[model samples]
Target: MKMFGKVDVGGGLSDFWAYIREPRPHRWAVWGVALALTWVVFSGVEQYLIPVDRPKAQIIYFENWTADRSAGEIRADWIARARETTRRNARKRAEYQRFADSLGIEYDSTEADRVTRETLGEEAAEAVKQRPAPPPRSTLAERAARGPQPEITD
Candidate 1:
């Protein structure tokens, strides 16, 4: 092949090279980017796709809840234990007993009963019969007021 004035101009290679070399926007790339942007705006950024029934759920939970009686039972059990564990006996025992009385629970103050309760099981201590039940607190009206639900929706 010898160099001459003849120009090479056949096939679409020149056009293809020109297209690749230039920084023109392609249709598919532009469409794909627009689709992705729209998807992100609608699906990722937007909220309230499915609303929550928070108030109803909270009301149901509030209805299901009962005042736990175990706390009072635990306190009575601890008091029964404290009666025996001497060293810091008299004053503290008397103070808590008075507090218990104030709370409408009758606590056994006798040292002998305390000893009997500690040595024998609680059944043996049943002879004195310390008030096992605490005074019930909180009427139905107060329990009904669970604060405003944040996600109350139509």
Candidate 2:
């Protein structure tokens, strides 16, 4: 019923504004402290309270139909890729060697290539040795004995 009644609110805000408007020796100091406090509060909220939703990395995978290929075909393709990679690396090394020569820096391209090839070969051998064995193949008779498998529904 008393919507327009005079409520006694403290003059804290008015007093603060008055102090801000009035110039004094410690006015700048107060302003600096206020700014520092504001910065601290905002930085704290940004660093902790705000939920930062970083955009998720979108990964697109292209389907490679290499599974249906024969072992010989795969090996041939791998060898071709290896040769192309070696050629590209050799070209890069030659360019770098030329740059080094221009800069009066000693760079032995042959030695670098030799070392790289040796290390690459060693790693390739290690990888081949560490390769997992192929899964065991099941015969038709075994499948018949096991009976029909349940249909997979999405």
Q: Pick the candidate with the highest TM-score.
A: 2
lDDT of each: 0.63, 0.71
Can you write out model 1's per-residue Cα lDDT over 1-154, one digit (the tens) per residue?
Answer: 8665586675468887786677766956876899999987787544566555565434333443346758888787777676556424543665686688667676766775576567556764564465444556654576678655488789
Cα displacement (angstroms), candidate 1, residue 133, comes to: 20
| TM-score of predicted structure 1 | 0.18
lDDT of 2 by residue, 1-154 (tens): 9975875456767887787798788988887999999999999999899979999999998977566899999888888787677657765776776677666576655565665556466654454345344345576899999999999999
List the candidate 1 regions with Cα displacement exceeding 4 Å.
Answer: 1-87, 111-154
Q: What's the true lDDT of residue 77 in model 1?
A: 73
Looking at candidate 2, what is the lDDT of residue 47?
Answer: 86
Q: TM-scores of all models? A: 0.18, 0.38
TM-score of 2: 0.38
**Worst ten-residue run, lDDT, model 1?**
57-66
Residue pairs whose backbone atoms clash in candidate 1: none
